[model samples]
Target: MDSLSLIELFLSALRFAAPLILAAVAGLYSERSGVIQIALEGFMLFGAFVGATSAHILGDGVAGLFMASGFGMIVGMFYGVLVLKLKADQIVAGTAINMLAWGGIPVVSKMLFDVTSNTPALEASERLPNWVPIVVALTVVAVTYVLIQKTSFGLWLTVAGEKPEALRAAGVSPAGVRWIALMISGGVAALGGALLSISLASSYTRNMTAGRGFMALAALILGKWKPIPACIACLLFGVCEVAQLKLQGVMIPGFGVVPVQLVQILPYAITMFLLAGVVGESRAPAKLGQS
Candidate 1:
């Protein structure tokens, strides 16, 4: 490819990777704090729906983004409460949250806008600043890295995940740390979701995340739960998606046109392959998934 083509490809990769970066960083926080972050998908979905709907209602995309973040945190709080207070299994609770978002968004959309599947499309001017989401996502990755490596909270988070009793001996509540981590995770993941509707696409579609949440989870694991490495992993996955989009239709000698559907599976397929091959070598927190 030409230099310009390479630049274009790189830009597209960044665009596609933005949401994954956000979600993966969010997962990093929750998982590093000893919480299984399976509910990222639900968090993203809720964010997308709430962001789009709020933007339409308020006529301000930035406001919508904040709204999305707030609501996402609420959902996160709900999830945290269930797991921390009620002692629900984290994975099961997370799965239920995902299912609830998948079904509940449509119901709310239909009631509010008379459309059961998607929110009304936002005008270009009504969407958030185009470069904002990507910048925010990258910033989140940086902030997460700093928070994990440079600060006291980072130590708390590490202890919460690997040695909760240590944190308790330090006079901190592991449960409190985890609850805050999950809330932050929800807010960050929600921004990724908002980007999907307000920056990348013009409207919210049912299940518009299309398993990007799961892909982000894979990236998190592949990066061994570090902020910078996870961001790098997300960028790699984004490149695969961009390739899928760019290679939509082409003829190969004697093979006919390339199947677009197969191309669409590229990122997901790569994610699964990496997870199966690499995750065994990645070390998770010793106390991860412990209540």
Candidate 2:
């Protein structure tokens, strides 16, 4: 590829990876605090629907983005209450949240827009600019890196997740820390969803996230829950997606056209290999999910 083509390819990869980066960063917050947040998919869906609908109605993408983050926080807090306070099964609660958000968005969309699949297309101003996702991804990575590695909150989070009793002895509430982490996770996930709908696509389609949430989870594992490394993993996966889209027609002399499915499978395959010890074992919080 020429220089221009390479630059274009990198941009496309960044765009595709934006949502995964956001979601992975969010997952980092939750898992680092001892909560297994499998409900990231649901949170992203909720954000996408809310952001798209708000933008369609108000014709202001910024407003929609803010509204989506607010709603995501509410939902995240709810999840925190259920899992942290009520002591519900984290996995089950997360799955339910995903189902509820996924099913609810379409139902609401159909009722409001007279369509079961998607809302109306947004105007240019009502959709996020191309650069928004890149900015958000960078911001999340930077903030998370500092928060986990350079702050007292980070120490508290690590201690809470590794030894809650010790945290309690030190007058910190482990449950509270986990709750805050989950809420942050939810907000970031929602931001990812907003990026998907407003920045990447003008309308919200059913299952638009299409397993990106799981991919983010894989990134979290591959990155070993560290912000910078996790961000790299997200970018790597995003590059795979971009390659799949751009390499569709470029013919290789001997290899011929690469199968689209194979390209699609690359990120997951990489995830598996990383998890299988090629990258060393991932060390989660010792007290994660323990009462």
Candidate 3:
């Protein structure tokens, strides 16, 4: 590839990877605090809808972005209350949230916009620039790494996840820690959603997240929940996506064009391979899913 093509490829990879990196880092916070936040998909979807709606109404991308994060925190807190305080099944609660968000968006969109699935398309000036999401993702990754690896709060999180009873004996409320972690997780996931709407697509569509949240979960597992590794894994997945998009029309001597289905399978295949011990065993928090 020429230098210009190579640069374009790298930029595309960064754009594709930005949301995944944000979601994975967010997942890290919740999972490390002993909560299995499988509902990140739902949170992201909600955030995207909220961001798009707010941006369309207010004509300010930053306001929409913050609103999305706020909505995510609210939803996350609800999830935490259901799972942690009421002792509901974490998996069921998460799945329910995803179902609710995925279904609710279309209804809301139709009611508000008189359209089937999305708000109006945003102008370029009204959307967050692509570079903003990339910078935010990189900052989040760096900050999360430092927080988890070099701070007292990080130690508390580890202890709470590993041994809640021990944390209680030490006068820390493990439930509180988990709640905070889940809120942060939700907020970050929402940020990813906002990035998708405002930076990636500039429009809201039902199910626009398109399983990126689940992909983030896969990256988290593949990276063994470490910040740097998770970032790397997300970048790899992003590259796969970028390649799929870029090669859509390109023809080679032996292969006329690669099948889109095959490209779509790349990330999942990598996930399976990583889980099969190619990247080493993944260890969840000791008390993950425990009430």
Candidate 4:
């Protein structure tokens, strides 16, 4: 490839990976606090819808970004209530939330925009600059690393996941720590969603996130739940996605011309390999789902 082509590819990779980076960090915070957060997809989907709608209405991309994070916290708190207060199964609650996002978002879109499709197309004035997501993702990673490695709350977060009784003895409520973690996680992941709608694309389309949220979760596991490594993994996945796009019509010796649909599976297939322990084994926190 020419230098210009290589630069374009690099930028495309960054755009693809940025949202996953934030989502993986979101998982890091919640899972580290002993709460499993499979509802990340739902939270992100909601954020995308809200972000697009708000940006279109206000004609201000920054305002939409803030509103997206705010609503995401609300959804996170709702998930907390289900799995924490009501003792719902974490996996079940998460699945329900994902389904809820898929079905409910379109309904809301219909009511607000009179279309069971996506929100209205955003004008240039309503869209964020492409570089915005790349910067936001890196900044979030840096802040999260500092908070997790250099703070008292980080200690409580560790204790909550490893030994809740110990945290209780220290007079710090493990549940409280998890609640704060989940809320922060929801907001951060919502920013990822907002980035997808406002920065990566012009507006929110139904299922616009595709499987990026779950892919982010996979990246988290591949990185063994660490922040910087997880972001790196997200970027790697992004590179593969861009490669797939570029390879869509290329000829393969045995495979012939690559089908677009087939090429798109590269990222998800990698996710499955990671999940199946093909990449390596990963251990979760001891009390990950314990209330």
Point out where model 1 deviates above 4 Å: none
lDDT tens per residue, model 2, 93-197: 999999998889889988999998998999887888888899888887998888878898998888887888998999989888888888888988998998899
Better of 2 and 3 by lDDT: 3
Alpha-carbon shift of residue 85 in model 3 (angstroms): 1.2
Give the number of colliding residue pairs in candidate 3.
0
- The per-residue C-alpha lDDT of model 2 at residue 83 equals 92
- Please provide TM-scores, in order, for all candidate models, with all chains considered together: 0.97, 0.94, 0.95, 0.96
Q: Comparing 3 and 4 by TM-score, which wins?
A: 4
The backbone clash count of each candidate, in order, is 0, 0, 0, 0
Q: After superposition, how far is residue 171 of candidate 4 from its true place, in Å?
A: 1.4
Over 24-105, each residue of candidate 4 has an lDDT whose tens digit, in order, gives 9998888999888898899899889999999999999999999999999998888899988999999899889899999999
* Model 1 agreement with the true structure over 1-291: per-residue lDDT tens digits: 799989878878888899889999989989999999999999999999999988988999888889999998999899998898998999999999999999899998999999899999998887876577778888888888888889999999989999999899999999999989989999999989999988888889999999989999999999998999999999998888887876778777898888988888888788878988998799998888996
lDDT of 3 by residue, 76-156 (tens): 999998998899999899999999998888888889999968889998778987788889899999998889889978878
Name the lDDT of candidate 1: 0.90
Per-residue error for 190 in candidate 3, Å, reads: 0.6
RMSD, candidate 2, Å: 1.8
Best by TM-score: 1
TM-score of 2: 0.94
lDDT of each: 0.90, 0.86, 0.88, 0.90
Candidate 2 local Cα displacement, residue 204, angstroms: 0.7
In model 2, which regions exceed 4 Å deviation? 2-4, 254-256, 277-280
Q: List RMSD in Å for every model shown.
A: 1.0, 1.8, 1.7, 1.5
